[model samples]
Target: MLSSTPLRWPGQARASVAMAFDLDGPTGAAMLDGSLWGKPEYFTFGGYGPYRALPRLLDMLEAHRTPATFFVPAWVVETWPRQCQAIVERGHEVAYHGYQHESFFTLTLAQQRAVMERSAAIFKRHLGLVASGFRTPSGDWHADTPALLLDCGVTYSSSMRGDDRPYFIDAGDASRRLVEIPGRWELDDYASLAYTRAPDYPAGLDRIASYDQTLDNWCREFDGTYREGLCMTTLLHPKISGKPGRIGVLEEFLVHMHSHADVWFATCNDIARFWAQEYADD
Candidate 1:
């Protein structure tokens, strides 16, 4: 049996594209145990996202009149309220990532629930925003994740790679289901750009792949998804893609996309709500 019923996206567009950012900031790097906070280079590296890349990204998106989703860690939101606020002010969807980019596998179920509650509370109280969508920090989850998110009032999750289109998970409750937006490793920035000595992280490519090569890969995915009338969401990291050279690659892809009139640029929340209503079984 299928996890979710396959359905077309809203507006009859050729394909839907959700340009999402994981605004991790320094939270992931700094919050880790035994982090070199004394040297602070890692923290600075993540901080570059909001301090420099965010403004550039906002300008680029605004100039193109596109709305996007930003999955932010709670620590980042609390540390950089102004930047997080700017995202809300600019009319983008701010969704839950995690408290400090913590992997769900590392936490107990009760711990996971606490993380969700705290992040949601911070988003509401500090940013005046309530998020209905969630993307796990590590794109991995325990079996209970769907039901847990549903309990937290989350409507959609973008962490799974089960399909090219949106689907639903039963969440073990026949009455409630969670929408899965589906993300691919090939479409994520860390797949191409992240380099680390940390034992916990994956190794980057042999060398940073050229911008042209990466763009080609992304465009090819977009082209195929557009032809199939499916959803294609590109997961970007500000610290990685927000750089001068890499940002151009994204800009070029957007320019290419602008030529197509049939594409729908949407937020994950918008897509999830549409799917829930369109595919809901009575």
Candidate 2:
């Protein structure tokens, strides 16, 4: 059930919207490929995101003049410097996804720490960004995940679905709370759009959703979010939503959203900072 309580959006907007992308690229697939590293069959499937889909998606954002956040794996940033550079150059926010797309549940606390440290270093070295936001690759949240993000200076997390609007997690510390910008599977493209010969957990539906239906659902969700003055955070992947047809649907949604004069389109970090300043205890 969605919340009916209102939220205080920035700039007196009726509601807020965040367009975020998980640019996992080949890192995740390769990591999942185990010993078969560099095998084009599964590896190249992810490669398509950086090589083919990214530019198209970027151009679409540019055309819409919309600011977005791209959560990318450290390995992807390291592997495709130019594409990563392009993302930075375009004035979009780059936040941590992980070293690879490995789930925190599969790793020990120590392993998670190492991954964050290495990924943070990559963010600094390559993009000169000390990232303050994180989205887990698999949306896998362990008991220690919040504290781990806090230790890494990640003030905001976009992986949890505890609420329909932004809220704070205890962070295992009485004094400090972590801001959570919730995301739902209904707003993600992976389940409906992504497919593979050998299926994984989210095997992805056998058939891709038609463009009209996708746009309809997205707009319907946004309409409710706007009516209740809550935050709507959508999760997308370049590999899935960057298809020409899907991109068209996204553009249509943007157009419909833009028609509403009171909508505030912003990055996830911007929303988190706003909440910290406005809603956090002094």
The sequence of per-residue lDDT tens digits that candidate 1 reaches over residues 52-113 is 99989998899888889999999888888998899999999999999989988888889999
In model 1, what is the error at residue 237, expressed in angstroms? 0.3
Q: Model 1: runs farther than 4 Å from truth?
A: 1-7, 196-206
Candidate 2 colliding pairs = none
RMSD of each: 2.4, 2.2
Backbone clash count for every predicted candidate, in the order shown: 1, 0
Give lDDT: candidate 2, residue 154: 93
Compared with the true structure, the alpha-carbon lDDT of candidate 1 equals 0.85
Top-TM-score structure, candidate number: 2
What TM-score, over all chains together, does every model reach?
0.93, 0.94
How much is 8 displaced in model 1, in angstroms?
A: 2.8
